[model samples]
Target: MIKWIIFDAMGVIFIVGDDTNDLLVPFIQGHNKRILKKTINEVYLRASLGQITSRQFWQEVGLGAQYPQIETVYLDTQLILDDGFTSVARMMSKQYSLALLSNDVSEWSAYLRNRFAMDFLDVFVISGDIHCRKPDLNIYKRFLKEAGTQAGECVFIDDRCKNLAVAKSMGFKTIYFVRQPKKSDFVPDASITSFNELENAIENICQQIIERVIFY
Candidate 1:
């Protein structure tokens, strides 16, 4: 029986909703300014996965040009957690072995852990610490080793198609989270725009597995 549910942070747990693009659009549009450096998404990921320090990341992206004036905006823009994250996490803890598998840097993951106090999580794996990122099946294999569970017994949820495909290939039942439901998309084991929908997904997965086991 499926005994665990693994969640991806960032896109799956938090919703930024193109807010970064929202900020950059105005400046470039008004001035016809060329984007001079790495995209904010790249810089954010670099810092988030521990490839660079936050200061170095911000500076490289020209946030240092404005210095203290935009420090708050820069930091705030990168790490906005979605609403209802903690509540859903807490609720899921009651049912399955709730785990978070994130490709994040040391500092960013620390910030998120502090912000949410993820005491409810049974396994919190961060790629920065392990020096491995997902979509590389090794990371998923490592998680299986650490959790003492086989891939077939776990459900992996990620927003990235590449990552989800890897997990699915490794025998995990995969869920692709959509930011909003569309009229057409290959249905996942379940797709949820919000954390509130997670419990029902878990229950459905459990029922499906149970039926399969009975038939076998």
Candidate 2:
């Protein structure tokens, strides 16, 4: 029986807009834009792993001098909540253990926790905090340990196929969040585009589990 519901933060729980570059480009646009972009991409993984501080990341990206301005611009550009997901999460928290597993930085994660009241969550396995990111088996195993649940006893939800694939392989029931279905070898147990659909999908999964237990 599934006792925990694990969610991915960025694309699933929060909308970081269509492109993150849209948020940062305005603050650091110049002839060195391409160079700065390359630098950011190179350091992003390291930064997310907490190998470097948030201040160091901004500095490496050439926005160190305008850190405050760039930070405001980035925050203003993205919507924190992904519409109905917050309500769904709140409702689900009452019945099952809730966890957040995300490839996130420390500063933004701290800001998010402060901006939103997510006290219902039983575990928050952030990449920066753990020094590991999803798609890495160790991270998923870490989540399982921290969440205090076996992989088979949790439902993992993510917008990325690669992340879901890893969870599915590790015995988690997977849910894929996408608007349009695409051809992929990695198939999710459930696919949902909107939060309304997600609620129904989870309900159906739980019902199936109950039915199986009763039948056996």
Candidate 3:
């Protein structure tokens, strides 16, 4: 039986998952159009890997003077908590363990969690803290370790196929969360376009798993 539900941070929990792509690059370019998007992304990669502090990320982007405000103005201002997610999370948390696995700057992730009152989730495995990112099985392994659960006992939800693929390969039941309807070839054990459908999808996956166990 699935006893845990793990969510991805940026896209799945927050409205934007790839914040570097959706938030940072544009913010940097807006300030200095001469700075190539590629360069901005390179610096963001370092920040997401914990190689640089959040302050250093702003400094690297030539916004050292604005570091204090950038996270609020550039990141938090643009990112939003997905509608209905919190309500569903409240209902589901009573039934199953909840976790968030994210590829994000450590400080930013923590701040966002606090800002959005997302500390309700039982566990958070951030890439910046661990110095690794998703689509890498290592991160998933770390999540399992931190959550104290077996892969088969967890349902991992994310907006990215690559991330889901890694989790599925590691014995997790994968749920593809379609937040903005991007094209994807990877199929998941289940899919949810909105949080309203989340509980049903999770229940269906659980029923299927139970049936499989009975049949086998």
Judged by lDDT, which candidate is best? 3
Q: How many clashes in each candidate?
A: 3, 0, 3
In candidate 3, the residue pairs with backbone N, CA or C atoms under 3 Å apart (3 or more residues apart, or in different chains) clash, namely 10-16, 10-17, 11-17
Error of 1 at 132 (Å): 2.8
Alpha carbon deviation, residue 161, candidate 2 (Å): 0.9
List model 1 lDDT by residue over 76-142, tens digit each. Answer: 5555677777887787777789888888766666666766678888888888777678777778988
What does candidate 3's lDDT look like per residue over 183-207, in tens digits? 7777899998888999999989999
The estimated TM-scores of all candidates read 0.77, 0.88, 0.95
Judge candidate 3 at residue 198 and give its lDDT: 91
lDDT for each residue of candidate 2 in 1-216, tens digit (9 for 90 to 100): 879999888778885422345544444555236555656566767888999987887787777887766665665555468778778888988888999898878777777766777777889898998898889999999998887789989999888899999999999989998844667899888988888887788877878878888999
Clash pairs (backbone) in predicted model 2: none
Ranking of candidates on lDDT, top first:
3, 2, 1
Model 1 clash pairs are 48-105, 49-105, 50-105
Candidate 3 — which residues are off by over 4 angstroms? 182-184
Cα-based lDDT at residue 170, candidate 1? 76
Error of 3 at 149 (Å): 0.8
Model 1: lDDT to the true structure: 0.72
